[model samples]
Target chain A: EPEVTQTPSHQVTQMGQEVILRCVPISNHLYFYWYRQILGQKVEFLVSFYNNEISEKSEIFDDQFSVERPDGSNFTLKIRSTKLEDSAMYFCNSASDGETQYFGPGTRLLVL
Target chain B: SQQGEEDPQALSIQEGENATMNCSYKTSINNLQWYRQNSGRGLVHLILIRSNEREKHSGRLRVTLDTSKKSSSLLITASRAADTASYFCATDLRRGGADGLTFGKGTHLIIQP
Candidate 1:
């Protein structure tokens, strides 16, 4: 089965540095989402994207966060400045009609 | 902020036994989905029960939804050691907005050999 794929299975960056997490959702999927899970915490929604624009975002997705589908196949999340609290497992998901969401293996972000 | 909260934070069952986990939500939803996640991994979609549906079964897994009570249950019968993982229930609200799924803390299930 076709599945969502993410690059840099793990990322480590300085506290004030910028970092980009990339994902390639299923080719035919229209809705894309980003979620994060702090260690030992529930997964939290970050943002959703459709038509190359942000549909909705949570408080955690402040000015420091931005998502882009720079190409037909790549969905990237950029953090302008990383914070220690931002360290978590970031997951990328895609769904056709908001029914069943397929998730990627996730990228573990560690902000030092 | 309405999310599915699963009960019995953790469960330990013997192989070949049945394990049941319950989830409760606070809002009307279009569908309820169950997912499994291995430690440090991504979520794996297990099953989805729509609002209009009451029960569904796939393989040895069974799920029942009670819309009136705003609760759902997932049962895994004749489970194996591989079934050990964290199970989460996610709610997909009916609103047409950018409503992403809200997940609960999840239940850590461990199957003993």
Candidate 2:
């Protein structure tokens, strides 16, 4: 089965540095989403994208966070300035019907 | 109470035994989804039960949704050692699939061989 794919499986960056995480969602899916999971914590939604624009976002998706579909295949999440609290496993997901979503392997972001 | 709160944070069962997990949500939901995550890995979609549906099955997995009581259950029957993983129940309000999912803390299952 086709699945979502993400790049830079592991990343270590200094605090205050900018970082961009990339994802390639399933070809035919209409909705894409970003979610993060802190160590030993629940998965938290960051943002959802559709029709080349953001459809919904959470409080965690603040000024420092932004998501874009730069092209037909790539969906990117950029953090203007990394914070220690931003360290987590960021997962990209896509769904064709909006109810069942497939997830990527995730990018582990570590800021120190 | 938080949305999509699961009970029995941890469970240990022997191989070939049945494992069941329960989740409760605070608000109205259009659908409920279950996901399994191995340690430090991504989520694996297990099953989805719509608000109007009472039960759904896939392979050995069984899910039941009760909108009136605002609860759901995931039962993995005749499980194996590979079934050890953290299982989470998420509530989706739909909003045309625009809204984000509210996930529970998850139940950690251990299937001993």
Candidate 3:
């Protein structure tokens, strides 16, 4: 089965530095999303992208966060400045429509 | 606020036994999905039940939705040791465009062989 794929399975960055997480969604998928899970917490939605635009975002997806579909296959989430609290497991998901999302292995971001 | 809340945070059973997990949601949803996660890994999609559907099944897995009560349940019959993992329920609210799913804290299940 085709699955979503993400790069840099784990990343360590300094606080206040910029970080970009990349994902390649399933080729035929039309909708993409980013979610994060803090240790011992529920998965939290960050943002959704479709048609090269953001559909919706949560409070956690504030000024520091931006998503881009720079190419047909690559979707990226960039954080302008990393905070300690921003450290978490970031997941990328895709779906043909918007109902069932297939998730990637996730990128663990650790900011010190 | 979390949209889905699962009860009985953890469970343990023998390999041949059955496992049941329950979920409650606070809002009307277009569909509800169940996912399983092995430790330190990504979530794997298990099943999805639309609001209009009352029951669905896939192999040994059975999912039931009670929209009127805003509750859902996932049942795994005759589970194996590999079934040990965290199970989460996610809600997709119809009004949101492609905003993605809201997940619960999840139920940690241990199936001992």
Per DockQ, the best of the predicted structures is 2
Q: What share of the true interface contacts does each candidate keep?
A: 0.64, 0.78, 0.80
Ranking of candidates on lDDT, top first:
2, 3, 1
Runs with alpha carbons beyond 4 Å of true place in candidate 1: B95-98
User: Can you write out model 3's per-residue Cα lDDT over B49-85, one digit (the tens) per residue?
Assistant: 9999999999999999999999999999999999999
DockQ of model 1 vs. true complex: 0.72
Top-TM-score structure, candidate number: 2
* Residue A34 miss distance in model 3 (angstroms): 0.2
lDDT of 1 by residue, B1-113 (tens): 24799988999999999999999999889999999999899999999999999999999999999999999999999999999999999998864455588999999999999
Please state how well chain A of candidate 3 matches the true chain A, as a TM-score.
Answer: 0.99
Score candidate 1 by lDDT.
0.93
> What TM-score against the true fold does each predicted structure earn?
0.97, 0.98, 0.98
List the pairs of residues colliding in candidate 1.
none
Q: Report the lDDT tens digits of candidate 3 across residue range A1-112.
A: 8989998999999999999999999999999999999988888999999888999899899999999999899999999999999999999999887878999999999999
DockQ of each: 0.72, 0.83, 0.78
What is candidate 3's TM-score against the reference?
A: 0.98
Docking class of 2: high
